[model samples]
Target: MTAPAELDAAGITDPALRAAYTTCRELNARHGRTYFLATRLLPRERRPAVHALYGFARYADEIVDDLGDGRPVVEKAARLDALALELDRALDGALDRAVPGGAMGHPVLAALADTARRYDIDTRYFRDFLVSMRMDTTVTDYATFEDLAVYVHGSAAVIGLQMLPVLGTTVPRADAEPAAAALGEAFQITNFLRDVGEDLDRGRVYLPAAELAAFGVDRQLLTWCRRTRRPDPRVRRALAHLVAHTRAIYRRAAPGVGMLEPASRACVSCAFALYRGILDEIEAADHHVLHRRVTVPARRRAAVALPCLARAIVARTRG
Candidate 1:
């Protein structure tokens, strides 16, 4: 990780900059409370940088994904792309010099530029993330696993790549990076499975029509609210296979738990197990996603975290 030759104005210690940092902290705590809670368990030095990374990622994601009007998608993407470039300049230490001439600060970017330096997070990931955001703006369905993976790569995998530096790992040690990417894919695929009806209403079918046809399940039953399961053997037959695909991805995400630093392992472990548990719930319900979205309760989240937490604690004690 390289340090900047000179500090950007974003991190200048003037009273106004200090106040902005305070505001950023409060805003992140407000909107990112859950991620903040998880980060609190990490080593103290790692927490702020990680929170900042998550804060920026979540903010960028909210843009194209805003879902209110198509208008926000275009506006947010432009802002995000510009913000990404500003971050890059701060990283290079050559630009982002806050001109001598009067200039207004972008509130979020002001804080994020310092966070990038503090953690050595790469600039490219932030840039690539928007390309993924563009996909969300235009592409919403999956025809093949290849296409699905491409979408996941831009949306989720790059996020893991961004976080890698904050965890204090080198690119070579970045071997664990792939596992992190897989874990994110697990999170995304679960979201898609759970949101099938919602996505379909927007004229998207995450579960391919071709694959559904294999089961004799028509689009109306899958997209409409009437039936959660099928009376036909072909539908039943196809769903069993679909459920397994969900399970397989969860299994793929499991090994990544150990890939995270021990202090950060608990949250990922809980998420992984809870998502797998949801898959089990889907199986138990016979894949009836329409009646309700499957969820692992708070109790279950705590229960899943216990084992990983204990393991992390024990490892620290020995060390």
Candidate 2:
């Protein structure tokens, strides 16, 4: 509903492309409530690029998760493959290329293509992300954290890697990559904690079997608890362990916030606090993530946001 600030900062002038980027921003605002909130702390020109990135990820995710019901697994795999091919073409400088049969006038792809070129973001990151989405269609559970890292590399880590360019880091990418990756994985693990029940409904388990076993928890027990709405002490213990692990990762990721360009610092800092707030919410709710999604309250969001908003305004005014 808000006007996308596209004229000066993003260098987008074409009416069609501006509209495409606006559509992506709308998607980011609609579905990724926390993400969109953090994005608001970015300088206005920078917001659209972040939104385009989210749009690209969200489009592929919807194909894998939302459209999966009643469809054959083979059909879903084919769709993913088709999308990968289309993405490949777009990244290779051919936006108008049709997806095999017909023209695919997807605005997300259009905006993503523009953003990728603008920021010189690597195509490999996009490739890895699509690979993970493809894996989600078939892989239901992980045996070990090490085994799951293979999936997380693509789904989570590369996302931060992709975003680093847009965020404009102060140091070489190699110097910041570790912190970026740690932060990304931390956010993803937090999601796993909050969405255990929902993932079970989709016939998936994100928690590593080995780690769950360490806490005396298992998939069958988790499924039973979800069905019965009974909270097990062991399950609570397992979630607490996960929360602690994610907190450590957030610590590892924290130093990288200072590595970003001054104007981008507040945005990433706000995101860091807001996402870490979910873990705090889980603790406050007594780790009852199995029953409902835990969230940072609007008042808490505003509280975190107010300081970052002030910092961002100062950064922009000085620029």
* Per-model TM values vs. the true structure: 0.73, 0.94
Q: Write the per-residue lDDT of candidate 2 for residues 25-143, one digit (tens) a residue.
A: 88998999989988888877788889989999999988888877668879889999998888876766533342221222577887788778778788888999999999998999999
Model 1 C-alpha lDDT per residue in residues 1-319, reported as the tens digit of each score? 1112112322344444344345555556676543544544444445445545665666676665543345655675576667566656544541245332112264445455666655556666767776776676667566767777777787777776676666543235467777777767766766666666566655566665566777777667665442444344554456667667767766765766666666666655555666667666666766666546666666766776667667656645663
Stretches of candidate 2 exceeding 4 Å from the true structure: 94-104
lDDT of model 1, residue 191:
67
Q: What is the lDDT of residue 258 in candidate 1?
A: 65
lDDT of each: 0.59, 0.85
10 residues in a row with least lDDT, candidate 2: 95-104
* Model 1 alpha-carbon drift over 4 Å, by segment: 1-37, 70-107, 168-172, 208-210, 217-220, 226-240, 307-319
- lDDT, residue 31, model 1: 68
Let me know the TM-score candidate 1 reaches against the reference structure.
0.73
Whose TM-score is greatest here? 2
